[model samples]
Target: MEVVVSQTAFNRIRCCVFDAYGTLFDVHSAVGVYREELGDRADQVSQLWRTKQLEYTWLRSLMKKHADFWKVTREALEYAFTVAGVTNPELFEKLMEAYLKLECYPDVRATLLTLKEKNFKTAILSNGSPMMLDSAVKNSQLYSLLDAILSVENVGVFKPHPSVYRLAEKEFDLYPNQILFLSSNAWDVCGAAAYGLKVAWVNRFQQPPENLPFQADVEIQSLNELPELLNIK
Candidate 1:
């Protein structure tokens, strides 16, 4: 469903924080590069990898078993390969390396440039480890565009956690409402919103929202729509 939220909901925001994985970087692009090798099961492997990666984070968080996202990613990929009946070591190694340079969405650079020009403090708060997030950012040539790249590794916990949300406030020294958070994951949106950050769910896939207690202030199809929603030029 298309969300028609009021633009006024975003007028008071000062800082802009993003979720890195499915939001800024195209996560499935790893499998995309190896589609020829994987053949018909490429899509299934990619989707399952992503789905299990998220489930592991939440499960680990709930279980108080903290592991860096790099480990979780590898574990998830192994399971995905097993389910898809893919067993090539070289292909596995290739896909893993490909993740370090996942494709940047076309809308990202332009939107970040607009934010930088307008002086909005932009950063990424992701479940990825600092090494992983930094590697992806630099690989995608976004090092200069972001003010910071936050990782759950800092707090030893993942999303929807109050402490992880607190990392942004500590970095920018601003209250949650003053920071406008953007995420493609509905669950991440719920996490930031429930933490009191003004949030915009980047509904890139037009997927339905999660059945969570919190909801985003608005939903946009792309970051290109952000400046208009924020009343920026």
Candidate 2:
């Protein structure tokens, strides 16, 4: 993989901050753990759960009716199960437990460890509640690789909010521009950019941006391609 960036842009990043769930971790794998419960409709159930989880957060955040990330996640699961014509609460709990144990992407541990070896600061700022983020990081074996695991719970809001970005800034004691903010979610990339971070959109799905008012500073498909983007070996 190759990344083309001007020398000036390459020189500016000292720290790398990642969005936890879809960026480093594979949310889909969590669905597979519960495939037996969902029968043949596991794929649809998983997709809907993810989609609704995000939608619930955005809507609740906008309406000022903020529920913590855990509640929203559970609600999304409930809705997904209902939509899939399933009615097993115990099965759903098992699925949620599996979600906490979602695996990291194939390249994630290696890339992150490489970044650490190169002495670049690393952290995760996620929409996940503190408890959820902690479990996810621990399960993925990323706890030591990351310097900090930040959650929006401190602010009672979600990503795309400037305050959430501030959590990263405050943790590293650096300005937003000094941090390389990466997310699989386009709106997050846009929001971080607007907040003055140099953004990287990990376009794992190869989809176009969702009409955000701003664009990412860089775009790449995988963490395997990331080191080259920042001129790391």
Candidate 3:
């Protein structure tokens, strides 16, 4: 699947920031928890839920209507259920709660620990609300590993917005070039790279190259390989 392709080395990167959802936590796992009740439409609902969530964010940004990730997520799930013609209050609430404690990917902990040990600042810059980000990080036992958990809500907008990217700069007081942004979302990679951060596209699912103005500085299929690319042994 053309997994590993290295371009630039560490190059004075001080902080390694990550995208939270698909990049570290398994977003689809939210639906996985209810697969039995969801039946044959489990995959469809999950896929639609993610798609709608992102679409709502972008749409809200363009429309100048801001809603936190939690609300956006719930609305997205509601839309998915409506489309699937399924209605179950208990299952719905459970699915929403599942996201707060989404299953983390296996490679995440070790990667963060390795970066922490190497003395590199690690953080999550996500479209998630502060509470959502905190829950996921703490639930995954990764809160202690991070130097910062930056949320777009602080800026009152979703990502790909120029203001959203500036949070990292303000938080770390580091120049854009000094930070390396990693995201499984190709569009997010484009956004951060366009905003001038050194970016590594964590292409977890071997998705095709994004048709966007900017591309990743490095690409890897797994987060486990990030340490190697940064020249850590």
Candidate 4:
């Protein structure tokens, strides 16, 4: 909703790290892929499943009991189905597989190429497990443009964990101030900002931040405006 960084600050960023899932790929709308599978209850089932999946991730991380994203995704699906009173295990598996085949956001590939042409190092810092991210990246064919696809799996944690933010900075050997971390999840943007990296909150839904004490350097509705914010042109 507000711009916190100056043109000078944006220009200093040498690498642009992004959050996967909702940031680059439309993970939340994965329900559309399962709508036909669910028949009449399609929309409700899909929404419930996605909501529970993210809740499970946060709960599991807080308990310090780790399950990779895929495992948690399945567990959440099962819980959601049980809550929704659905009985088909076959349909559940089919829906989860659809996640493996998620399409990138319309502006993603073009934006990545634009950043690359500007000579900025680009990578993904995700809560996704190594195999989960690898499968998604490989399947989407966007891995070629990425310099690194770092995940929290190596640290057995999730985003908002300061350590995960540090891991990305270390991997690129860039100063925290030199990296511009972008995420659609407000908490993740807050975390990266707290960790001292310049941050951009991709408020794709035009929602407010989660009332966090920290703020993003810039907040844009989509990646389409990112190059302009960073003065890439």
Candidate 5:
């Protein structure tokens, strides 16, 4: 399906903000490094690790107890290890290191470059800590293509939170409708939409639409379609 931005909303977009993990980077990639060690359980471990990591973020946000993404990530990894019955300390360290350099999705660099060439302000809005984001972006060679790398470290909360969504408006000095927020996470898309941003849900995994109060203005299967969706050409 084509992007569905209305003319009015389309003209209001001054900046494009993206969620880092799962959207741009392959969060499951870390497990690929130890495919042999994980055997048949690699996928399970990755899924559980990611699920718990996000769960911790939401739980902490609601409880008003915030921790950086790194801590939450490590804690989630430990839980995944226990649940999956993987018990190598060395493998744990390796997995954490791999996460620092997660592979960027194939279409990310070209899409971001297209946006940059079009002079659209592009930024990363993520739950990653500053250090984590720095390493991932630099490692993926995406640092120069972006205008900003925003982290929840500044806000002490994870996504689906209105405050996290507000960081884009605060950083760019633009209203929510003037920013186009993209995320692979449906709940995040809902949160940004609810907060008044023009949103595009990058349904990379072909997941079902979320049953939330707000919905994204557009949905696409990959970043390759983004520039066209925004009429960047």
Candidate 6:
């Protein structure tokens, strides 16, 4: 759990592109808001919702039947509700609204501010829809901190896909080595690294690294440590 950096990493990085959900924003915060309504099944529903959400994304990607993240999110919610056997229209609506305004992780603001001050171009490359990302960024007051919000909607596919990573390169007009891709999702770290981007895995939950072909250039427990790891200051 301390920040781990490769000696050669970050030297050529000119941009830091982050994953939105789970990396910058807390994905479970939506369910947390409706905990009282779901009672004992709160945690179960939350976990299942997140699991199904990601599963659907990958499944859709493989099937070549792409859907926007918001659609996937709602579909996942419906499945979670069915599995949890608790369905209240009001509760469902509340959870959906909560997601639009999901709370940013505590370290996000300061880390992004640091990256901005250091003259690094920061952006969000996410599976979220543009409307969803816009709401969360505005709600978190991070709209001005980021240079771009790159959504998978643009390519009609989910991440861990090379095309998704290419959006950042195209938007920033930078090569893979000049971009530092950050994500809490280990698979994403591998995916970005496989695509030749330097990656910093923000392992906030202390999860094990993925058994993948590519490894991240750095691993840090929080975004707060990213500045130091990248030698930004």
Candidate 2 vs. true structure, TM-score: 0.95
lDDT of 6 by residue, 1-233 (tens): 34455756677889999999999999999988878889999999999999999999999999999999999999999999999998698888889889999999999999999999999999999999999999999999998899999999999889889999999999999999999999999988999999889888889899999887798888888888888777875
Model 1, CA-based lDDT = 0.92
Query: Candidate 3, clashing residue pairs?
Result: none
lDDT of each: 0.92, 0.87, 0.91, 0.85, 0.91, 0.91
Tell how far residue 120 is off in model 1, in angstroms. 0.6
Candidate 2 per-residue C-alpha lDDT over 1-233 given as tens digits, one digit per residue, 9 for 90 to 100: 12356747857788999998899888888888778777888998999999999999899989989988889989999999999998887898988898888888898999999999999999999999888888888887888898988899889999889999998889989877889999998888888988888888899989888676777877889988878887887
Candidate 2 ranges with C-alpha deviation above 4 Å? 1-4
Instruction: Please provide, for model 4 over 1-233, each residue's C-alpha lDDT reduced to its tens digit, 9 standing for 90 to 100.
Output: 76766778787899999999889888755668767667777767767777887788788889999889899888888887887788997887787888887778888998898999989999999988888788788877888789999988878987788989998789999889899999998888888988999899999888878787888988888899888888885
Given candidate 1, what's the lDDT at residue 205?
94
TM-score of each: 0.97, 0.95, 0.96, 0.95, 0.96, 0.97
Model 6 bad stretches (over 4 Å): 1-8
Off by over 4 Å in 1: 2-5
lDDT of 1 by residue, 21-139 (tens): 99999999999999999999999999999999999999999999999999999999999999999999999999989998899899999999999999999999999998888889989
Q: Compose the digit string of candidate 5's lDDT tens values, residues 1-233.
A: 33566555577688889999999999999999888899999999999999999999999999989999999999999999999999999999999999999999999999989988888899999999999999999999998899999998888888888888899999999988889999999999999999999999999988988777799998989999877777775
Q: CA lDDT of 5 in candidate 4?
A: 64
Q: Which ten residues in a row have the lowest lDDT in candidate 4?
A: 28-37
Answer with 2 or 3, whichever has the higher TM-score: 3
- Report the C-alpha lDDT of model 3 over 13-93, residue by residue, as the tens digit: 889999999999999999998999999989989999999999999999999999999999999999999998878989999
How far residue 221's Cα lies from its native spot in candidate 5, in Å, is: 0.8
